[model samples]
Target: MSTIEQPRPATSPSADWWRQAVVYQIYPRSFADLDGNGIGDLRGVTSRVPYLRELGVDAVWLSPFYPSALADGGYDVDDYRDVDPRIGTLADFDEMTAALHAAGIRVIVDIVPNHSSDRHAFFRAALAAPAGSPERDRYIFRDGLGENGELPPADWTAAFGGPAWEPVGDGQWYLHTFAREQPDFNWDHPDVREEFLTTLRFWSDRGVDGFRVDVAHLLLKDLPETLPSRAELAAMDRTSGTHPLEDRDEVQDVYATWREVFDSYDPPRIAVAEAWVATPERRARYAAPTSLGQAFNFDLLTADFDAGQFRRIVTENLAQSAAAGSSSTWVLSNHDVTRHATRYGLPPLAGREGKQGVEWMLAGAPADGVDRELGARRARAATLFLLGLPGSTYLYQGEELGLPEVGDLPGDRRQDPAYHRSLDQGTWTYDGLGRDGCRVPLPWRASGASLGFGEGAEPQPPHLPQPDWFAEYAVEVEDGDPDSSLTLYREALRLRRELQAAETLEWVETGSEDVLRFRRPNGWEVVTNFGGEPAELPAGRVVLASRRLDGTLPGATTVWLAP
Candidate 1:
């Protein structure tokens, strides 16, 4: 690798960089329109690094900028070494890395190890080769033709929809947990492992600080197919008939393989795994000290509305994570899911409680399909929940502005295959809608026209106009407003970093559903009231608030008190 001895920028200790450190997830297409193509490009992201630095994040996790067919929104890599032309060229990526490094902000790219697009050259070569060839072993291919070659050897459901197995040009079958366009790679193959490591070195040599590995748990599945019995399948409520629980014990070897590769790089890098399994145990396992540096715990994202629910989720994760690994990650929203605002809002109630029942009553509501006012409260409340936690926190792009889910459409309206296959043919109920709502264009500068995110020079008439509510809530607009959401976030970040507020903190339920108390050994307390009822809070010092509470906690008040 060639060397470019740019002045070494000072970075915080690797161990402590995560604390009080914010990470912004950039969904390339919606971030900015660089070529008038309506899609965000690498240069667009490079141009926005200054904006990210201003947001107080130490690093930015750019969602897959690699060569892809876009079958899975860039998750399906066709060539791991190259950058996609749709987003930008390799030169653009170099520029991005240099700029981010110069600004003291690290860059973390996504490496999808579990699968690859069907059009990938390796898979194509395997397809043309005869059965039992060395190349054919690189992927999982089955030749059993019991059910007209359409049925797979086992009864596994594809994550995108339908069966997980599909027939290629020949008489053989290939396994894909997502769209048929994506073929699952056999990690058991030595060549497969080498390819991933080389890919890591390719970008690491290009100055990528680290990686946010995609679907880390799915990289290795149960071997010898363990299908549940007919009666057991009927008794269960989940879509796990063909799950790989049988081979769960041996899956860590796959993670260990990646860890070995990351260890080879200088200055030691970080890896954040996306453990998408149902159980917290599996998620915790991926974050084991010997495994990846961090694995996101979605339990925080799936908590109930009350303080008790939040407490239980936090307590459970912290306990499990402490036992399994020293650290874990917390996330409220991401590209494939609904915005927090839409997920936590209560529906319109005709009862006497009115909108007051929104948070508590609708705690389980999916983030994508909620009403407006309830969405805002839920979004802001979620921010408080995320920042006050003990572990590292991840903020999806546009989360700070409290962006809500975009409305669903019928027919070609929906782009996410996951939503289309499972619920209402593409439309999701409050529970089933997975990620369609959060995938819309970001509301950046409120030109009042789709928040300035359209593809062409002229904005589309039907474009979801930028959330006007953000005019007062954006970074630029809120720099002066001491009471704005943007300001609250900035202050919370500053407190978390400067005062070490979230470190070594213990959450104590103050005997009130409306009030949440966070106590630290340093004689500090953080209280937040999600309810309409006011509660007496002990006096110390006010650290931050969504709205200034008049004497006590009123409805929907969040106060950070230090004693």
Candidate 2:
């Protein structure tokens, strides 16, 4: 409602700001609550612009705030152009964007292009129209395989679980890669493609800095004859090749068109694809010059905490970025999976692939070899190591406060479709499968009705309950402590901005195999000791350390040094 200065354009003549920018991810529903209705909204996010600016991030990537049925946590969009009433209105979004820009931070909103909420106008029209009508062509509607049409058209399973196809009467079934409420759009349709381009322009015209493309790799499906069963597809190695319905070659053409719209702006807008494809080479294609600017490199998220594993993933990711002539985007956690703090604390599980690793983490008992202290320590070190890397990095909401995954969420409070889907498969408990844990509202104050997340006459409860231990990790508590995780993040980000290193990484070998060391083009060196013993620091002055350092760096610690 008040006048605010607009942020400078994101583009720079000499360098791409995104190449090494630190982007903070804000999950709106859980970020902060202004009206105290217990849900976070656009105005809530607007009020936090100063907090982000103080944290020293170049941009803030807000998850979807569009009108939705809340199925799949707003991923199933009923309308992409309008904001969900629960979040705020278009005016609120403009206010938030202006406030962020005034704080000198760019804005990147999530764009879910893979599917639309079944309640969407287009989907609703498709459902009411005759099977062969043009209206029905907007989505992936097909005839049943059985004579009576009782059987699903394909053997594909949904990513959340259960059958990917849901029956919709008249021997017709619609494809939904996620929940049944989310119907996959037919990318092959000329109208569908044009609609998304219009959506892109709508936001860019409103001053959005960029977009984080949801399910970026899942726009196109393989030819019917080449499609494989869910079982066989699951067994295949993702790092070796592509999947039938995921990351198909046709997806690139869609991004190329989106890229054209981005380039039309004065300071070209950017996009980062959430493409979880197989192989770094395949992933690199998504970040090609004519496609999206960046694709999330998630190898580090699943890599073992071992030094060797980290080195291999880092090297491969850097190589992939070089091949594509684009800077890689590194991330440790997001809304879809377990938080890194709890994950790093668990014992490494060998021979696990794909979602199996996440399952193993979720199934593990707190008393069964899981150490929260160790996990926190490793997470801090991991943060320093990741921030020191060559390219841009993303920090999930509440990660800066050293938040751990709440694995023991009550079944009644569980909202993720994965949890309900697991129940559908006859699993009694959906403990780890659901993503409600990491989606909990942040603890801003040590004590409050909702931990200072909301302000209303009545104490507004968070969408999900915060654990009893959350108070200890509250922002107010950590903000006052110099050694707190929040402080560590703030300092690390400040130094990263100061260094402004070129996009290059060179490994510096330490004699100990457990110690990983590397130097950046800005004459900054980073060292991490994964061994049980201390390792001598590289020849330089220590600028920042994840933990207190004496003459040597302690095990499970990292330090940034200046030559």
Candidate 3:
């Protein structure tokens, strides 16, 4: 409890700092390990303060570290106010928070408001209580359909794939949009709504800068006895549409209340909603000034490497965000998705919708159709382009190292609920491929028994296997390589801050629609070549380039030039 690293005093509001901040996401379990258990812990995060400060990020968004049964990768939060014992203690969190603040980096912890682990005290009590008990009122529980109550209450399917309803015996069932282990909360309940507000104040008081509201749009108004049909659900009604179970109008009130709680604090604990809504316009509501203040724009995350696609994604996102008076965000890879390096490297289909279907992702990323080198190159160029944009940037942990998805993960050892719950008529579908590949523990050293994660000498294997090739992207290996992706990112981030006194973007026509060329209000421009042959760079002094410049910008390359 030394004063030197204790939480700093709150300051005046940060005046919309999130609009242009660079937020790095740290998937706690995969970030770094402290206990010899091979899983990352809070103390481990405290140990990385210098590295985070060195990266020049404004804040770190720590993914769920709440107590859980590892169902749905800790999104099945059992407790809102405390850290899991396996990860570390509440004292560890406070220390980590203080340590991060001491480095001038803020903290944004994940808050899974939509659901709770079935093992949670309330959920367990609800299961044991009678059908109409107040305990059952805290969760969505209903009687089954068939005569013997053998059928689920509705035909609704879980996001991961199986039926959304889980049997609780006694002819009753509970609703879980994700896995059965994660039972959705009854947002209609006063206790549920008030409890989250308390949770928010608890963390804000603990010195967290913000909350990354998980599944921010999935909370419900109230669950009716009958549910909407699949066709009705598919018709998004111009994207502002709310589904019967998922999105509803009342959820807006939930966010408004949370916003009030957030702003009540000095410096105002800000929030970014992880709302996967139907349209960009819908997503913007979560970022409305009176709401979470920011919402993640994920269009780029699922987009192909084609230049045209990136332009359209950014343009559309910007328009939607502006129309709603909210700033846009850009992200490439995260713990939940297949890493961008792998996505961009795969061979494109002749006329298919996406680069490829979920098949390649589910099939261990077979080498037959992948070009790792090509993918890494696009990923590097893409980051440069994003840094040149006019809004906030979110960087997934291993992206700076150009880590490819470890798609060859053995199925037997996988822990993502998507793999185990995606059962449709007893056949495993493409959706069954969970996000284990991208969530593997990060490598800190080029050679170590635990990649210098935590365990010394002898250690338990990481929850997910790390491919031997991870060494190439390990901190020890890339720290010394001038041309490494790690170096490129550090330099790009530094220059981004210097170049982004800009609030507006001006398109620098490069003749070809296939080349992305845009200049910020400052005299710096970012040109990325995606088409065949070389795209000429605009006349300016070179600041940085994803690849060595040989007079012209080569395809899959990007460069920033200063006036």
Candidate 4:
């Protein structure tokens, strides 16, 4: 009964095409605007397939573009079966999918199963229906405490910065681990589980290559009585240890069911989890053969810009993924956090741990003493080092042009719920809590009404403003510059495909501890110098260097060598 035509058997490099693939993450609203609406849509995305293809990424992982009221920036889903009208329709998505496929790039859509927009039909019905009705059962609704039911049922805090419970007018409250407008689904309910399965198939039948499961670690939670205090939760180590609301063992069961659905197709679909669990071992569980195919390994993303830290994390990540019988995932930047260029420029904070690293980077005053040129140099070196590794790599949009976080975004134009929640709770200041800095629209051209993001004169202004300096890094400006970051990324990706056949990596001992040298099975070696001085390159012909070299790998630079 599916309207989609059966896909041709994949002519991909291998059945496990995800392995060794370089995937680009595209935030739809900011990518391009084909309709002159200022917001990037599926048509805009379709028009850019060739750009991505030429960029050398093997796949594109689009952020949520589903129907929503724009709460939490489309993470709040009102309907799972269709696209938001602001972005495009189902037909537009289909067209984009076909275009990407024709360009030999896989399409991985974002799926938010942990919660639904309060405006979703089921959530709306639950609000209007009386307490104890089945409509209410689809979500986690509970009775409030105290004499007038004024107090919340639990002490858990929202990830966005407020109480996790939101009261519905009828003396009952619903759980929302994030913004209040996004009501958490009761995964324990058969109806909720069945609905997600149907939604998964709805897209699968439409020929999406795979899905990226958002907040994959938070599908299950302990009973309300067992919820921990905010302080205790904050102090908990996500790298290890159990949490009432995160990385619960029961969540694997959910993915096991999803795995069955994924395998039903001829080529079998793939899925990667946005799971932020403690320990690489625990993170690997989500990528086990019977569960999701891959889980994002953020060890590299969270590691300090130190040689020892990067080496240790890379070793740990690879070992854990090997134990899980899955390939590891590497990523530098994503929409939710500061771009790596800016992060590298800022001094590392002491005692900062997982997820806190994001906050630490955001809260720090970059204006006081950030060396952006140094950050760009290091980021470029890191990109070559990341691509040289033996696994999948995810590139955030605009990183190719070395975009730095726009830390000075005006408060009024901010959109992240975290920013508003912080103000409402009298917690952190709004200056760093919001994520608008990293979500600014890409500047496609050096100059235009909207930097060539939208077509024609009188094009709509972007949802966010592009800084004047954006013109310096625009795609058109860097397109022909051989030394530009965009050129470096394209060349690195091209060379990566040629050098990626090697499945094993062996560490090469360098005299200095600050230098990391690794040799691939294919006689290709990657050396990164993180010390105060230049390091002698390994005895081989230089294939590519992050920056110009004078017969030595400069400090904060990386080079790929062919023996």
Candidate 5:
């Protein structure tokens, strides 16, 4: 039986809240500075609760604040119940939760149930115990399993560029999907499942409204022999591949277990999966009413800039949901990869080079930049495409400002683990520029050094000089400027909130190869032109625009039409 209290009929989003709700994801380390330290913490986040509310987001996904070694940027948790010292103490988290709740914004924290940092006490105990010992069984420990009994378990590779298996002595080997310092948890073990359940309860009891499950599909894998090919494994040596982490049948079981536990809480919490798989069948299974409320659709992440391609991606997702009897949630980008600005319809930057010209053109700028208008126009076009889509959209930090990837971090100063991995693998030619650029701290104000993201001045200046036009593009500056991108977002959000638009979305007609159209259940039309040429739109009151579509939207643009 669900312990969640059913809200009064009038309290439901079907009547009010959800419809066009926006979720702003805050990578705490880069959101704001509270202690004069360059790092952003819970207090800094707490101070900005109102800003999120003002931005019209109904929820805020606070990335992991758990105690960690900072390896893999806090995904390697040393403890789950406490806040990291660098971020703050548990008390700060309590205050942050209270503050966000008071302001009407729900809080979602990242939960890493798939693995833990090697420094974690549980891992320490497992290491100290003998092979086959009760504690050792909590992890994937096996003796006498390698060739000459000297190699790792099977030939699985690590997502961080090496063998997934590492020796733990005693002739035993352990698995690590990512960094060696982070050991994968044995979800097959009953104890592992129990411990994670307790961790989930600890946060929910403390008022976390939901969780953005970290690499949720990594809970299980085939037993060495049945794993993907060495060639296939090597190709994904740098992704959440290496071992088969996702679209695995066993992952659904984990979601079912967590869902049962979550249902015991009040207000009915939500769970989201960071699934980057194309197996929509398996993806949908995780969204069963008894499982997670949301799972990311990587189709858009891999989508090409064509009307047919876009339609297929969106339609396939919707069909998958209907077939599986599940609801859907959408996202543009998160903290893990390169920013969308550099991912689609843009030029080759860092992580995207050596791929294809299309990838650059998708996230890169058009050849013509008579002025900065080309970049600005591309930014608006991307934003329109993002906002005009159906389902819940995740706004990565600083993406609303059309910020590009940071191209200036010195090799020594680079903070991403991917860069270090590339260097270790002798693939040092790869630049430290990709996603790192989009992950830099949010430039809150441009008055002083660090751009007001920290107290006084930062040891380093803000990444990419602050956009001077922010005087016109910023949230503070655009509340009054109806034509600003920030203002446009605000208006789009408001229009989406209008009762009729909050329901499900449906694709109506996509006539023009360059122009695509979809209808909101509320009778609003969302249209776009991905081509680099002007395209016509059905005449209607324009609520959102890639360039204020008065007649034709320029190449790579979007506009919302309402009768």
Candidate 6:
């Protein structure tokens, strides 16, 4: 159950409040910097409690802020129980939690159980111990294939790029599904499982309302004696659990156990899985009532700004989650992907597995690769459509300000390990940008060192440089604009709290394939026009809209109507 206060309705708010909530994701380092360190810390988050409350979100999901070398943007966490001194301390974290709770906002922290930073004590110990030592058993260390054990054990590739195995300069190799700095834990080891449960309770006791399980679909790999081709594994269905690395069947037992630890607390803590399974059905498995209880539906994230695709994703995800006795989740953008504002601007790429445009995304705005205005309009429409749905919604930081992807960020300043790894391997799979474009520090003010992100009297350059164009999307500028994306998000969140009392979604066929319409049990209607022509407004009062609405809803627009 969500511990935050909700608008009282006929339904009990204390029961499964996350089923219909607005959760804002705060990437700490980019959110706001305090102490002139050019790195956002816990104090900055605590100071922003008022802004969060004003945004009308029920909860905030903070990305990992633990001690790290920033190898993978803090996803490579060195410790689970404490904050990075560069960011803040454990006391700072406690204060942030208290402030958000005082403001009636629940807190959910990121947890990476799939892997551990090479700097983590366990990983360090494993590295120091002999190849056959117990410390090495804590992680997935194996013998190499070559006679000298120089070559990697298998042909498995890292999700980022290159070989997934890293040699310890000894006779053995260790598996790291991501960057070499993050070593995948051996879940078969009892100590590894116990340590995670203890870590969960540690933060829960400190008042974290929930957790966001990083790479939830990846755990408990099935290491076959005979390694399979990476291409063959890629072609296999993720739901089948036959792929040696992802969505393994044994991972279910782990969540079932985690559910027990979660329920032990009064007003039991909740968790949402960042699972990227092949289908809604596979994703739903991670959110089963006895599991995490919530998982992201990313189909919509990569979907083109089309009406039919949105409807199908909603229908499939909702039905699947409901069948699993869990609430659905809708997300447009996050730290890992291009922001929707830039994504919707790029034309759809057909031969790429229904993925949205990317060839243009890496082009960095040469000639006319991006249609920014069109993307923004579609993004606003798509967001409203997402908010009108009957489940929780995740809004990435800076998304409220309509921040476009910083695709042109200089190569020297790029910090994403995925980008460097791909480049080093000569793969350049993400066109050399990787995830850095969307992970840029947010712009708060029109001008200043780091765009007013720091509270220090002396300005400090942000860890990542903010572009000059960011001034147009600064929160300080948009906050006062009535038609700004910030305004749209604030109003939409506020009204959704007021009208989204029912979980049932009824389709309102608009007689056109390009137009999508749906109604709630409370007589509220959400309609979007993807067609070239304007869609006639249904018989209801215009409550709110992505753009100003008239007698009819214009193309690339979404509007909410009152009974």
Q: Which candidate is the best by TM-score?
A: 6
Model 6: colliding residue pairs: none
Provide the TM-score for each candidate, comma-separated: 0.86, 0.93, 0.94, 0.94, 0.85, 0.95
Residue pairs in clash, model 1: 38-455, 336-435, 337-435, 342-367, 343-366, 343-367, 450-465, 451-466
lDDT (10s digit) by residue, model 2, range 126-219: 9889998898898988888888888988798787788889999899899998899999999988989988999999999999989999979889
Greater-TM-score candidate between 4 and 6: 6
Candidate 6 per-residue lDDT over residues 217-263, each given as its tens digit: 88888777767677777777676776788898789899999999889
List the global CA lDDT of all models: 0.67, 0.84, 0.81, 0.85, 0.67, 0.84
* Higher-lDDT candidate of 3 and 6: 6
RMSD of each: 5.9, 3.4, 3.5, 4.6, 6.0, 3.3
- Runs in model 6 with CA error above 4 Å? 1-13, 235-237, 351-367
Q: Give the per-residue lDDT digits (tens) of candidate 4, residues 201-311.
A: 999999888899999999886665545667887787665435667888889999999999999976788999999877777888899989998999877666667899889
lDDT-better candidate, 1 vs 2: 2
Q: Write the per-residue lDDT of candidate 3 for residues 1-563, one digit (tens) a residue.
A: 01232332332257577888889999999888877688988888888777777667888999999999997888998999988899999999999998887777788999999899998888989988999999999998888989978888877778777788999888988988888889989998999998899999999999988989888888874555576666665664535445566556678888999989988988788888888877676787888888888889888876788888888888887787787677888899888887888888875533444324455664655465678888988889998999888888999998988988887788788888777665334434333467888888999887777677766556777878787878778887887588998888878887887788656777777789778888777678889998657877668898999989899888899989896
lDDT of 3: 0.81
Q: Name the better of 3 and 4 by lDDT.
A: 4
Compared with the true structure, the alpha-carbon lDDT of candidate 1 equals 0.67
